[model samples]
Target: MVRNTLQMIAAGCGVLFVAGGAIASPAEVTVANAERRLEAGADISMTRWHVDAELILVLEKEASRKVTAYLQSRGRLRVVDVSVSINMDDRVILADFGPGFLPGPDEAEVFLHELAVTLRHYAEQAGLPIVGVDFRYQGKPLKSYYPAELAVPPRARIDARNQTALVSASHGLVRVHPALNWDYQRPDAFGFREDMITPPYGDALQRLLEERSGSGVNRARNRSQDPHPESNRPWDYMSSRYHLKTLLPDRTDIWNSLPNDTDADREVKEDIRARPLYANHLGVGTMISLHTNGHELGAIRGVEVYYHGDKPDDRPLAESVLCGMRELIRAQPGYENFPARQDASPGGHGENRIGTMPSVLVEIAYHSNAEDSVALQDPVFREASMKGVEKGVRLFREGKTCEPFVLQQIPDISLAAGTSQEITLPFAGHPQFPVTMEFTTANCSSPGACRPSKTTFDDPNTPITVLMRCRGSLTGDARWSVVLRDVDGVATAPVEFQHTCSKPGGSPAA
Candidate 1:
């Protein structure tokens, strides 16, 4: 019998040769110590100023080197592209495989199994977090591997897991896709189209990412084409409202004539799906689909973030980003009434669902509303919102919890003046026990008009609901604010409320 030599063997970042045909035990690879600057600002504190983006870039390179070297030594496949980054829970690798690959899907599975072992082994040696690796061949994802500890939702397939890598990388290179290039949002109340208003927010985020990276914070990469060069000039009006009439002559308005999903809508959906595909192709870890909401009811306005309900990490990702937006938007002088409206029931978003990574589509504000339209145009507001998004990702990666208290939607009230109406202000959070609620009114015609039925919530497990009674003595919109003070005497920023009242002594209306 003739004995064949081993084809490949591993030994401490070096290949070893053996005369036996049996596969060698996986090598004990040792990586060089990362740059020392990585150690200086590696603060994973509960509340941190910022993480060094340059250091993160260094780590990314190290991760890529390890994975690439191991695969290259195998001599069976080529790494077309590789993206390695830190996620909220684990390190993630997205690799595009070129030819000299396996023969079939079953073979791909076997390759993935071996790749998983190699990735975990090298990741451990480098002191990197546990890794999840997704491989793609010719634009199709092959079987991938995720660490067993990640909170995989029920029945999550290989593709879902692959997409989760993108969503879960809270600290990795984030891919931002500006609004659709072809579709135009109906003109805002001021006639400025959504295409014009929202892209700047995306641009601001891109700039913020570059600025942070430039300042040694975090590197942000955006590859989408700019759809609106005139984004900064939002005051220039182009109304799509009337143009739809050219498509539907018989219908009086686009809102009534348009189907739930038109060809145009489907095209937009496909385009949305294409973004994450491109992002995945580039090996990005996460993506934010930025947009602004529009509604026939101008009363609907605030920040909304939609996530894939089925993905375990999606909700938390959305919550974290929303918390960041709330923190910064509330800090602005005139944005006290800005609400963190409850997200549309999760899942059901093509942008969030059709990817092999975590993606969240955020409606930053409503263009249909007069006030929010102006807010969207304000550079200060744009910068604040984008910064919040940047911080939110960092916080999520660090596993830091944002605002414990999230104020849900507080609807517009049409109440009779001089009548006291009890309104339910629903809230969700894990508050420190023994928190007390305080109410205050601003821009109100009647002083001391808003009062809370219960001032204290002693249980941490109970949901927060404030039974507020407001007496409207005059016509117009008035503001009510709620402040929750914890046992430690720490108070949150006021939860601003708005209610409209009819003339005094008029019949009560909802």
Candidate 2:
């Protein structure tokens, strides 16, 4: 089954062309990474930083205990600004920030997904690795924030688990090596020795896969062994506390199980499209929908990156993932970046059709990878993945690039031929933001069309209400749904709602 996967060059520097590796002029120490110099320096204040676009080009949003290490340790690599995104939870991604010249000025711009995609192609062609950050705010541009010296967020904390290392901060970004964990539910135990550094998840997976292939996916034939033996590592405070597990499989299974003709995917798709994060902001455009990619059976091994082919703008972002994966695979000393996509197939259509949508579905590694089992069983991956998820969110939300909270609580479902009841959904955003709510319905025919009978903004989280109005004449209740897009149009994950058409009041034809 030609699916959405791609392959390329042998182990080379992955997408993140950090110094010390092949990518040429390695990233030398810079003022940003100079701790003592920075500490003794003068007062540096942030000017402005905001994200107004859907995509942003950045090196990555890996974190450190102190801003000094983040920008300085790497040298010459002053964090012009890492492209990040924020959801209900703050998260960021290194790749979302991708390989780019990096941001400068009072700020870096996070364009809406549409605009970024349209223009990113030119940037990618020039051998650029910069990808886009997903911003959730309602079209907010990251304004310049400061004296690069002063404005940087406090140094982030760098920790390791099950041979996995993660640099993170409380509401900032965390760039972690993929060995951390492909599945959020799992986390490795016993951090990797300092000698073991995989570029990111892509690299880590390749390493583990290799050990297994050379030996076998099990305890009997393996050669490499866990260095840190902390079997009872405490629950990751952040992940466990927030329940930041990957999206439950039950949900995806249900989604895939539905017949294409079902109203479910249609309503949700409309909701997803209806709220293209930056659709409203003249400055903002489209977003590269980033999610914890996996398979219906949770059996796939590589990251399941999905991108919308319908949209030409997504070309660069799509290409970056495909190519970057290969680079990362080669960069990691150990590990193997396996491939299994429709595009990789001999008769495959090509790169154009890899994702379910323009979005990239990156299932970093199989939660089931044998090498990762010890780590995964250790449970470090959850915190590591959570850091990644948060980094992905933060890469788009940090600084002025922050998008107003996107309220995507829309739902699609069918109703009985003639019934009308009550329904509810979510309102994603900070409680303080002055959020406006609205809903509408379409595509009805036959005996009776179902509509929102009544809705109440009971809680602030999900706040769009619509009263369904029936007109057509069908048999059972007509199909209907609810949507709560942000002013910018970026929507939230969708849920389903169905109402009957047999109302107490005679088939009201409003």
| Best-fitting candidate, scored by TM-score | 1
Off by over 4 Å in 2: 1-286, 296-299, 337-359, 368-510
The TM-score that candidate 2 achieves is 0.21
**Candidate 1 residue lDDT tens string, 251-296:** 4322132234333233333234344444444444466777676654
Tell me the TM-score of model 1. Answer: 0.38
Runs in model 1 deviating more than 4 A are 1-185, 213-266, 342-345, 404-510
Q: Give the least accurate 10-residue stretch of model 1, judged by summed lDDT.
A: 1-10
Go through the candidates in order and give the clash count of each. 8, 160
CA lDDT, every model vs. true structure: 0.48, 0.28
RMSD score of candidate 1 (Å): 23.3
| lDDT score for residue 466 of model 1 | 52
